[model samples]
Target chain A: DAGVTQSPTHLIKTRGQHVTLRCSPISGHKSVSWYQQVLGQGPQFIFQYYEKEERGRGNFPDRFSARQFPNYSSELNVNALLLGDSALYLCASSQGRTQYFGPGTRLLVL
Target chain B: GQQVMQIPQYQHVQEGEDFTTYCNSSTTLSNIQWYKQRPGGHPVFLIQLVKSGEVKKQKRLTFQFGEAKKNSSLHITATQTTDVGTYFCAGHGDNNDMRFGAGTRLTVKP
Candidate 1:
């Protein structure tokens, strides 16, 4: 089966702009989580949704938000972005167990 | 609270040399997972160790979980150039929110 998929493999945006990244989980997966990985650092969790509900959130600020659809797809939104927000945003799906990650959206904020 | 940490930020090995990376947690973890991310590529899940003191092997790679459930290790025997990548160990606590370590970058030179 196809693995988790993300959209806009790469993008460039200026500071203070808004960006949205999309992810489609693997077949039969119910939970979707978001993570941000800066250069030379491990990924940091941002949010997690299960069954269209916010199950958990990380240490990110209010500028970042995410929502999962009933179909299990997810979108991550960043408003008034900053240069520090430039990173690889990863999406992962799981069934209350091991998580499978997507290819990720590489966002570069200039 | 950052829970997971990996030692030796980077490791360089001659092809056919052995290499190892360590992960430690400040608190006990219910399960731990490993992933490998090639340069400019997305992370790919390698293995998951659930039980304490569990040991699993795949080809030249061996993974071990400590009895305290607060440490883990990955060792590669006779490494090949294909093994070049960053190895990350992530831990899931009781709430299922995953926290990842900084990762150990491995370079295998021919």
Candidate 2:
């Protein structure tokens, strides 16, 4: 079976620009979560959506937002990007338990 | 917001040596999950611990969750070249948010 899929494997943008990363969860999965992983560090949770509703959020700022589609796909949008935003954006899909991750989008803000 | 702390930040070991990483949570967790990510790769699920004081073994890897649900550990026996990666511990709090610790990067030297 296919696992979670993320789009735009790599992206580059200037400071203050906006970026959007997409993710398609595995078939039959209903939960999608976003995470940010800086170089040499683990991923930090950003947002989680289940059944098209925001179920959880991390310590990130309002500039970070996400949505879940009816098909259990997800999109992570970051506005007013800063240099510190350079990191890998990961998407994870889960059912009752066990979260499967996508390859992630590497976003670099110059 | 919940916090998961892991240590030490990095480890280097001989190919045949053993290694261990510990994870601690600021608050009690409902479940703890472990993931491994190779350099420049995505985090992959390795195992999950739910019950208090639970222990699970997979091949040469052993996972343990503390009785208080506030800590966890991953131990590897006879590390191999394939074991070179970052190990992360994620904790799911009562609010359903999963927080990941700053992972421990492991390097195996042949």
Candidate 3:
């Protein structure tokens, strides 16, 4: 089966611009979560969605938001991007406990 | 808020040496998951421990959950160059959200 997939492998944005990252969960998965991974650091949770509803959110600022679709795909939106937002955005899908992560969307704010 | 902390930010050992990383949570965890992220790669699930005092082994790696369910450890026996990467311990909190530690980066010298 195909694993979690993400779009726009790389992105370049400017400060104060808005960006959106997409994620397609694996088949048969209903839960999708977003995380941000900075260089030399572990991933930090951003948001989690299930059944098209918001389930959990991390300590990120209000500028970050996410939603899941009926098909279990997800999109993470960040507004007013900052240089600090330059990192890998990962999407993970899970049914129970184990989560499988996507290759991630690399975002750079210039 | 729940937080997970890892010790020994980095380790460098000979290819045949053993290495271990520790994870501690400020609150009891519903479950703990381990992941390995290669350089410039997304995190890949390694294993999950759900029960207190549980132990699981995968080839040269052994995982142990503390009796209190608030700490965990991952030990690699006879480390190989292939084991080089960041080892992250994610503690499940808030039902659907997982908090990841800063991670322990392992470097093996041939």
What DockQ do you compute for every candidate structure? 0.72, 0.86, 0.81
lDDT of 3 by residue, B11-109 (tens): 999999999999999999988999999998999999999999999999999999999999999999999999999999999887568899999999999
Per-model tally of clashing residue pairs:
0, 0, 0
Task: Give lDDT for model 3.
Answer: 0.95
Which regions of candidate 3 are displaced past 4 Å?
A: none
| Tens digits of lDDT, candidate 2, A1-110 | 88889999999999999999999999999999999999988888898899999998888999999998888888999999999999999999999768999999999999
Q: Write the per-residue lDDT of candidate 1 for residues B44-85, one digit (tens) a residue.
A: 889999999999999999999999999999999999999999
| Candidate 1 DockQ, CA atoms | 0.72
Write down the worst ten-residue block by lDDT for model 3 chain A.
A65-74
Accuracy of chain B in candidate 2 (TM-score): 0.97
Kindly list the per-residue Cα lDDT of model 3 for residues A1-110, writing each as its tens digit.
89999998999999999999999999999999999999988899999898999988888999999888888899999999999999999999998979999999999999
Model 3, position A65, has a per-residue lDDT of 90
Task: State which candidate, 1 or 3, has the greater TM-score.
Answer: 3
True-vs-predicted CA distance for residue B17, candidate 2, Å? 0.6
The predictions' CA RMSDs to the true structure, in order, are 1.1, 1.1, 0.9
Off by over 4 Å in 1: none
Worst 10 residues of 3 chain B by lDDT: B91-100
